[model samples]
Target: MTKPKISIVIPTYNRADLIAESLESILGQTFDSWECIIIDDNSNDNTIEIVTPFLKDKRFKFTTKPLGYAKGANASRNYGLELSQGKYIYWLDSDDIIHPLTFELCINEFSWNIIDFCRFQRTVFFDNFDVKCFDNYNIDENVFFIDKSHIEKIINNELPINTCSVIWKKKSLGFEKFSNELLYAEEWEYYSRLVSNGLKGININKVLIYARKHSCSQTHEFNCNNYIRVEAKKEAALLIVKNLAAKKMLTYSLKRYFICLSIGFKEYNLFEQIISTIQISSVEKIKWQIFYTILPLRLSLYKIKKAIKM
Candidate 1:
């Protein structure tokens, strides 16, 4: 088989019902020089039976996560990255579907420009709804040149980039991999490291992917495991904060932003991790300590005020 120009790596769990749609979308791509690798994360459901038909196409390959490997999308994604044999990488989820022209449009942009990656817009579609009911999550910028300010904006949520909406130049990624330990915001943390390393890219300004929001999705599951989700965020924030500090791009607002992510969680040790990781004056440290101490009381007062107004 000839080496493909693009590789679509998808990590899936118990998505037997929806995995076929994602595979079909890939099969219908206008651009043909691509391979779709589906990495299964030990799904007990009939996910294998659903994906088997698609594997008849030479471009569609499927593999199961090896024993002893962690049971999450991060580990599966890392494995897919390892097995990929393409110049560009696009990570898709099992439950989502991409537009037929997704590959063609993004590939054209890469051919015309020198970039480490290309970012595109994605729409959020809920279950039991028409495809036309999707909502576009647009980024406010077009050209995302890697710089201190751009990186800060991403960390500050001013420029939100979705994982499925990106096509990454594999060589530009080097040895960077997702944090397998994190179950939430793993993409945010991984992308932060990539941007901080000075990878420049352009935004395509088109919605090429439809991200499914359903009860079974990992993001939705966070509602039940709130602590697990926040802990993951804290871990991801620590890595981002330390990376920014090392790059000398750490700012007061950025530090405050990450620190505040753990504010209401009441995890003192995790909060201290961020506080100690970033360089701050002793006086500022005292201020943080005071704020953390009174956080519960402050939250209670705010809740009371809100209740009274309501």
Candidate 2:
């Protein structure tokens, strides 16, 4: 009968082996005024069996992906956002673990200042949480006050804002939702779009989420040579470019970065898409053409050098 202070939305598929641990992490949270919503993307595994026990607690709600709806994590997350009944929303993966104090720290930050979202660092681990591999810590600064300029950092891959790290104010999101067309880089595009629209946020400089770096994870499977993943990256880049273009904030360096990604991923269509979105000088066009033509030579030379060393 009452809305919670925060809602944790997790989109999952066939994570039966790890879903319970993720749920238990939520159950162990120090903050109590929160609800957890799990949207299953039509998984064939016994994921439901693992989740059923947690439903008795009343704070955890589980639902299957609506039939005929776009089938992906993006769609599931959108549905979770629609069903959420909290002031703040946290997007988390089904296989990741949030620190016990995540909600308490984020809620405290929200209370002190009016921000669209609160962000924290995340640690990556493999096999188990004890064997940590990486962290998204900014060595030069402990706290980061983010604004529109940070969107460029995201586009440049200078910042790592994963789906699990940021807790967003629901109303501040307005009509924005995840792009269902994207299977990869959806979080990057969504967060970049929000930042481009002038969302204010703060980075708390604490690793509050533990991201699992197993081979089954999407990030691990995302390869530049993978056709579907490459297409998703192109779509995401185009969408972000259009958003920045509308705001008259599209920078030359940002455009170059997108072009490089497109070329590096072997998705030539993105080059044409970028040209159609905005006007490019003749010199820039020629430069891109030359770079595209020389790619084979560059690869050959690199391989030759490696073979010589071997």
Candidate 3:
């Protein structure tokens, strides 16, 4: 009945199986002053069955609609915004969950500083933690102090702060709008906008969220992995050419170059993929542009790592 300080938004589709655990985690949170909003993208499953019990709490609600990720997530967020009396917003995917005390702790931590957003360090569960985070190209960064400058450095340096481990003020939505065109690169593009709007993010020294992975996910479905590493770099170069055409600032040019290089050298073994994608002069020209494409055949074994999908 009381107005809350935080609104937790979840968007799901056919997640009847895992939704309960996520809800249970929230219900068990030590923080009592919060509400949860679930936006069902017109699922045919018992997702409603899983959420039905929580309906009595004025804090819990749901919306059923036919929407995919880009539109679905944005619509759900806006829907939560309309229902929420909270000044702060937190988004959790239906397949992911919050720490038992996450809302309580993060809200308390918000008072420590005025921030546009906060990013969490993740602890993934890949058949449990015994295996290194590297098993799936997932990383768990150590607790460290990060402020606005650090975030700026991260943005410029090509490191990322993502939505899973991310929370931000509900008000910031008014300044910059979410994009509807992008399904995959939305995070990168959105973060770029948030930063461009002068909103700063900090890394909370806590493991606040868990990102789940399975064969059905985008990571597993990324059919371009064979060319992903190489294509990523080519994408960077193309992005740069576009940036120059658009006359955008070159502040991160070096960073972009390395990102392109990193993708080409470390992420893919795609000579044929390159020929198919790029029509830039001769093979020798491509080699001249690339620093290490000329490495010995035996060295091809070095760049075979893939990032964990969440």
Candidate 4:
């Protein structure tokens, strides 16, 4: 049997009802040279039973999360990476749907493998089939190459790159693993490392995936008050800081780290942890302290505006 040119790795956890749609989307893809690897994170639901029918197709394969591996999507993705036999890798969530031509378009972007990855845009849809929002990733071109200079745009949220929108070259990612410990902002951390390590990419100004936004999503499970989520962001920021510092990128300034920390500041308790983790001048520390003091009020106002808009 010939090896597939692309590998679609999906990490599923108790998504029994939703997994079938995602699989059907893959089956409907115009690109035929691909394999789907579903890594189940010990799902207690009928996820396995739901996926059984899809196994009839030789292109679809399933595996349970190996023993001793961390329990999360990132860990499951890493395991899928190890099992992958494709020239390109697409890490997708079980609940998302890829457009039929998404793989064909992305794979077509590679000209002699000049681009290490290709990131497209996504549309967010609600349960009622209403389009909730569209994330353009701030892309203005049909296709554009991304390098280290764009790192700040990514980290500062100027660009929104989701896991599903990206298709990576296996060779460029050589043994790279997503940070298993980062429950939040793991993609940011992983992409930062990839860019810092000199991986070039292309961004397609087209929405090729439909990202489902439901109440049970992992993002909805955490709020500003969730300490674990906050800590995960902090850890990711710290890792990014260290990576940037090693690259000697001047963008790794104290102010930038403070901005990253600001995302996690829902309460005063996490301030000391932030200060201890980030290295900054006394003046900058004092500035951050002041910013932290006013964050609660600002957050309240933002929430009010968000509710009004909703």
**Residue-wise C-alpha lDDT for candidate 1, range 82-122, written one tens digit per residue:** 99999999999988888877888778778745688888777
Per-residue error at 92 for model 2, in Å? 0.9
Off by over 4 Å in 4: 128-141, 250-254, 260-310
> Model 3: runs farther than 4 Å from truth?
66-75, 127-148, 151-159, 223-249, 252-255, 258-310
- Candidate 4 structure quality by residue, lDDT tens digits, 1-310: 4899999999999999798988988998889999999999999999999999999999999999989999999999999999999999999999998877788888888764778999888777877332222233343565678887787777776676778889999989987899999898789889878977888898888778888888777666556346677677767777776677666663535444545465556454445655665556899788877876787688899999999999
Candidate 4 lDDT at 164 equals: 88
lDDT of 3 by residue, 19-135 (tens): 877787778788888878888877888889889998877789888744443454556555655666677877777766567657766676577565666677665554222322223
**Candidate order by TM-score, highest to lowest?**
2, 1, 4, 3
Estimate the lDDT of model 4. 0.81
Off by over 4 Å in 2: 131-141, 287-310
**Higher-scoring candidate on TM-score, 2 or 4:** 2
Best-fitting candidate, scored by lDDT: 2
Error of 3 at 33 (Å): 1.2
What's the ranking of the predictions by lDDT, best on top? 2, 1, 4, 3
Superposed on all Cα atoms, the candidates' RMSDs to the truth, in angstroms, are 3.1, 3.5, 7.7, 4.3
Winner on lDDT between 2 and 3 is: 2
Backbone clash count for every predicted candidate, in the order shown: 0, 0, 2, 0
